[model samples]
Target: MRGEVEQLVGILFRTLAEEGYTEAQTALLDTYQSKADTDREELAEELFVEVVTNLSYHLETETEVEVLVTAIEQLLSWFSSLVEAAPVAILAVETDGQIEFWNDGAERVFGWSKSEVHQRPYQDVFAASSDEMEPHLAQLQDGKQLTGLETQHQHKDGSIRDVRIWAAPFRTRHERFEGATFVISDVTEQKQREQRLSVLNRVLRHNIRTDVNIIHGHLNQLAETVDDTTEHLRVMEDRLSNIIQLSDAARHIEQLRDEGEDGLTTIELESVIQERVTRLRKESANATIRTTLAESTAVVAHELLPYALDNILDNALEHNDAETPLVEIAVSTGETAASGQTTVSVADNGPGLPDHEQAVLTSEEETQLNHSSGLGLWLTRWIVRNSSGTLSVNKSTWGGTRIEIRLPTQTS
Candidate 1:
């Protein structure tokens, strides 16, 4: 009798499956197995009633199944098109790091055919780097989702490309690890823009602060010399000169802020440095200026490239304590496993900053209202942050401070 009942339940489940009552059919099978004295006809009637009631509720909530399905299909189709059209690589990998699916975008960005990528280990696509893989693997292992992770991926052509990846784990109804889906976006250009903005912001702030200090010193002198007509005339002349300098500084700051990352255009970095050095030489006739720029070193930045160079040189000269201060400028461009970048170094034969002062320059803390001398460096740091580049201070070859700024070469 039990055997007959089992056979009857199987038949009912098959019938329901054929009628598209997938979930209801599974529920009926579960119920029949749990009940010791199962009545086939009664169980079928109960399942039918429950299925109808549940479907009716869903229909009321959804309005219409056909419409909902159509909308869903359309959305899926649109997403499919978008994934196909995107320029960056995309892949879905199991929690075990096995590739489950690869989109056309993956082929375009990673230079791998679908057959070559599918079911392969995700680590195969990553180049060997000390900082690579560990964080991503840890996140997956911990069952936590990760997003906006910037890393380098090895392409089929033996080149590495910078990519911003977002990953999230997927699960099935049985609560099993389905895998993780990754969306990769090429961010080489964005990174470069950030670097340029950082450098520009730093240069602007440093120049402004330096100009303001000079203005302050002149104002102090004017206040003291105001008693006599001859002294007052001298003070007036000094104030006028300081005002002009301040105005130029303000204009330069505005230009840096306005140009942003999009302002980077192909320009000869050597020429920009040379022009800045020439101007510095004229302005600081007593100071010694030298350059060691690579003749072929080219960079992409706004028309204000000369200004950034000028600010660095100006800082070196203004901060120096030597009788005839020396400023050394060096430029270099090179390719790395990830991308190409240009580095510029401005060093001065002056009193090198103490370790604590160097810390203050790089810290995100706002410059102190009362502290003097380091404000220019603070501003330079800010510009470097905006440009999406890095700024570091170290001992120069001349036993002074060296300010190094590195900017990415590519936009994307």
Candidate 2:
């Protein structure tokens, strides 16, 4: 009996040591040596063997019990390092929208330290609109993965940041709702880049289409008036002039690189609209132009403000069906305590744009709507987008198309 008791004690110490629980083994050894019993010796030996065998099976064979645990530990370590090393903000929130983990990246991106953000509600970290948070929370709860969600995020410094968040829900061993993990990256630069590209595409499409159509019409006229060589020569000169203008415009567009949003300058909104309206009147004798611009609305942009306004005006004039095509430019301004964005609308009594046309204009494939290839309105939309403005096509009061442009005002 004494020998069996000693054997049980030996097995417990051996199993604990093998598991790297050195302290547990030493404590068990002392307890077993003191509580040595002869009558229950056989039972203790059998129990000890069963416990060791079960533990070994758990560590080696039970995939969910052991493998998953080790994998999770490694994954957690890797994710922690990634969040700490990343340049963007990152956070892990529970199912209830409470923040469980906040990384250094979050600190750098949102200007909140661990002490400030840990275990707090995500809403407390930054001011978020219900419109923005509701949809995101719904997606997380549904276990649907979301990517590239663009919304405004208020910063600790009282400035607003345009942020894009990618998020997915995390589950526990029982497949129960644990929380959500988010990897947020600053996409402000990328958004600006897309806007710039859209503007360039719009300019190219509108100018190319208009010039090509003009050239085609002129050629057709020349063919009909070929009997008079003088008229043909005059038509040929006009076409050549159009070609030269297109070449110059192309050069200007090519010079616009994938630049950052740093060279933005304050621009007079009324002046730009007036210039475009005046130019359209002189260029399109067949079209009647009108204006209702506010006296001193201003915005921020590069030198492309004139070109963007020109594209909008040209689209309105070209698509109009009135005997004397009439285009109206209306400008207005407003302020929101939140973003304080200035709104300027350029509406026309032209034919309303098609649904597909609107979709193409807002999409990244805006270049596909080339005027030379039948994509004029699409390009105009691109220009509005590039200037950090919103463009929408709706039914005009004159039973035609209304084009609205909303731009952000420059901060004083």
**Residue by residue across 49-75, what tens digits does model 1's lDDT show?**
554454455345453344334444555
Q: List TM-score per model, in order.
A: 0.41, 0.44
Cα lDDT of model 2 by residue, 159-257, tens digit: 777788888888765767788988777666776787787787667757877877787777767777566557657677676656655555554444343
Reference-based lDDT, each prediction: 0.68, 0.66
The numbered model that scores best in lDDT is 1
RMSD of each: 20.6, 20.2
Q: Which candidate should be chosen as best, given TM-score against the real structure?
A: 2
Residue 301 alpha-carbon offset, candidate 1, angstroms:
3.3
Quote model 1's TM-score: 0.41
